[model samples]
Target: MRARLPDIAPAGSPATAPRTFLRAALAIAVLLAACSGEPDPATTPARDPDASAEGQAGPIISIRSDPETSAVPAWRAPDVPVDAGNLAQRKQEAAAALEADELFGEADDAIPLYLALREHAPADADVATGLERALGAVLQHGDAALAAIDDDRAALRRAQEIAAVAREVAPEREAVVEYLARVERADAAQQANRSGERALNARKIVVAGGKGAVAHFREALRLRPGDARAMQGLAAAESALIRQAELAANQDDYAAAEDWLAKAAKVRPDMDTAADARERIARQRASRVGNLRDLGLAALTREDLDAARRHLATLLRIAPAGDPAAVELRRQIELASHYGLFRPGQAFTEALDRGGRGPEMVVIPHGAFRMGAADDEADARDSERPSRNIRFDRGLAVSRNEITVGEFRRFVTATGYEARATRRGHSTVYDERSGSLVRRSGVDWRSDYAGKPAGDQLPVVHVSAQDAAAYAEWLSEQTGHEYRLPSEAEFEYMLRAGSQSRFPWGDGAPPAGAGNFTGALDESPGGRHWRNAFKGYGDDAWGPARVGSYSANAYRLHDLAGNVSEWVADCWHDSYRRAPVDGQAWINPGCADKVVRGGSWASSPEQTRSAWRLGSDRDTTNARVGFRVVRQI
Candidate 1:
């Protein structure tokens, strides 16, 4: 019961959507002081992370996206102060240390000794002046170390050690606090530069969450805006995006090219380079379009409509608005399925809108042909009298074979439509036990001639005319094209396929291995052979074979004359009194019966004639009947 064809491709969803993120922690923090009068350099409102010079304090990014986590060390954990005893002796010792130029190394150094004297004498200007000179020397060493961070990482570590000593001797000095923060920022900037270079070398150009080369390079700039290496890395990232844009433009995907260029603008923020790329794309677009048009037209000439359609899709994406060349190419491709471009007997298929494709079809040429049997034709019925000259001005395509179980299963599954036999729970099937046709229970479109489960390649039977029309309608919707049961006249003409003989072969008897018809040598599954049939022909088939099992007709159609009788669009009439002049369906609204054409394996010699016809109830379902469709160009 769950017999759906596995032709459709499964749908998919995006794995990850790109998004924006606000950097946190050590990613460039800037704090400003009160917007009042101009503040002096000591109270210069130090930013949280950056420093213009190693001697000054500012705010900037760090090694990580987080603001608080970085390579910059913390303010030296609270150091012990110099011992403040023996005030006069301490001052004299401090003076001697300063004169000897032993700044602040040991306990008896100039700055430490001065700090001990200051604690005893609150208004000691001499101690304060000596401490300032010692502080100046510390700053000179720290500033020089900060500048050397890019060349020598050990220098940055040395700068931090010196700043810690200055803070310990001159605890309340603003210059010491600023100098320490500047050194930390320079260290963070160096780490960011190194990280960016690693990512760039591995080709991690752009990541969604600020982990790629572009993000690292930008962070380095935020920490130290003048870093030459970081600046160069960022430029390289922008250039990569531009190269991608050019590649997409070459493939005729202008929308994707523009998308790449937009990303480049965000990375580099330059207008002129982006504009130049756009101009180059525009100049190349005309030539690309010309090449596509030429290739598409050539494909049309060769009847490679699929390749032609592909080129047309590319033209739609890259061509300028309302371009005449694009419009003309579209028209030419649309008209390719005609007499001028398409040859008779050429096979093709149409792509469905959702997935897969319609049944294989053979193009039929446009010409006038005799529709019905003549008066002198032997064994011709009254219904075939007064044969008229029917003309087909428009080229048409017919299914190469009868609709198979696999093809019909797709229609029933897509629409959840039940066939008439399934609704009735019974259909006429061949009873092998009695060697005769009998109504069987639970037999529907899924069963074969003997009421067994059918193979997918076997022609679908036990379906009413209404069910066949429903399948055709579903095909039309899936393919975005018109498809319906062929007209009775058209069916007969294709069955003959340039043959004027009684049968599709010639006047007398069928050729060897002609078709699946009633033959004297044919045997049924029950070991019974045909009682009345061709003298010595045996097609080796007791029931319907897989579609396209035998040789094709003159028009490259399979199983037309002998396989199964097929439903057509026309309603049954007694004679050709008021038949349609054009090869269109003849219908009386709410008619009781539908026209059936072609012969079956159980047919006698007369029944196997190309001019054979049958009129069955519209809702009748049987194993001996199937259908084929016609597609309009």
Candidate 2:
């Protein structure tokens, strides 16, 4: 019963088979279309061009597929005119989303959406207002970012971005542009400050009063108008320069001090320190002038003429050109040095002869002294009494020692003049065998008392007063100056020098080797009968030694006390009752005797006293007599 029901219809009925086949094909197509979610090609209608033109239905709108979401069927919809209500609803939805997400400023979100809505509905107040709000939000966000950035480049970038947005959104707005400009100025000011600080720290600002630093500081100020730090730095640099100038001045480096001071003046011409430093420098220079003047004057006083000249020259250089004291000091130095005799504590010669040597002279400065001897002086002769003040108004050149034999010989040779000893052909000499003075026919100025040959250095003796006068006159003629025998007063004045005692040394017994006196030859076999020997003193010589063999007196005059008696210009008088107070020779034409001062090698200690005086005939020649010349100044 289950198997045979449909068997008779199955084998050959054509109409029934065709109907079944058709039904199965139609159901397969419907199932495939539904599963694929695609409209049947037959049901898909063609776009209507007339409808699109009439705005009844626009061209079909094809929606693009989103790769991030599930795939949907790509369908085309007719672009129908949007409904006002629907568009309004869509705008409200987008505005609500923008508000909810607070994406009003976000360019990627609400800003683009608002822009699109504005394009569609250009007059929509809400869209315009929303777009404005979004733009403002963008500017605010950029500003916040810029403020948060520390790096200058980062800040600039942020500022530029804000400015760009503002230009695009509201081209007339200047807030962002102004902010960028301020940032630029601030950056420039900071850079200038840094550079200036570097230079200042390195001491490159050598000029005072901020001259070197001013340019940098000014630039910084221009960028950021009033900078206190820059002002302070400029002042400090100026102060440093002033201090350096002061230090140089303190060290007496006037040249360097002046240089630095000039720079300081350029820096701050009105600064108080600059004024003070200038004053101090002036005072220092003045003090130096005074110090130099003092040194030069002191040297002059000590007779150090060369040293005086050097110091005075330096003073003139440093002193003001017209300073009166400096001028006067220079004049004084010149006067002192005129004679070329400025050495102190030494003796020198002048007036060179053919032999290149002349009278050894001692410089005597103009001075006042008491001539002759004191009334109470022991052993002083009557002629030396009546002491009186005598002032030499001018400096004089006096011989340092008695004229020597060689010196006289040169004078005689040059003048070819006959001396009294050679003309007389005989002179008085000490006869050692007889121990008495005698006139010998062969003896002359060339022989000593003992008949020993006279050396060049021995004092020339046995010359008459006229012979000495002739010699002095010849010397004066040769040298073109007045050379003469010293007056009696001048002789005693020089012999005493500055001494007030009976003797030049002191009022004591003559010291051993004081001079060549009678005692000096006491032990000699031929000098026993000399009669006037100093009992306690001896010089170890029987006759005159070298002209300067003894110690010099204060005036550097040698052989003043002994060696030989010297002829003077005064006419012999019994006493000083009519003596002239002035240092002049008391001359009388009728006088037969000339005054002789000092003593001789044959004289006793009493006779060697500075004020002791004697007289001799004008033509007399003695073995114990010699003469020295004096030049009038």
Which window of 10 residues has the lowest lDDT sum in candidate 2?
1-10
True lDDT of residue 105, candidate 2 = 30
Candidate maximizing TM-score: 1
In model 2, the runs with Cα more than 4 Å from the true position are 1-348, 351-355, 525-532
For each candidate in the order shown, give its overall lDDT on alpha carbons. Answer: 0.73, 0.63
Clashing pairs for predicted structure model 2, backbone only: 209-238
TM-score of each: 0.48, 0.47
How far does residue 215 in candidate 1 sit from its true spot (Å)?
A: 95
RMSD (Cα, Å) of model 2: 38.1
Quick one: how many clashes does candidate 1 have?
Answer: 13
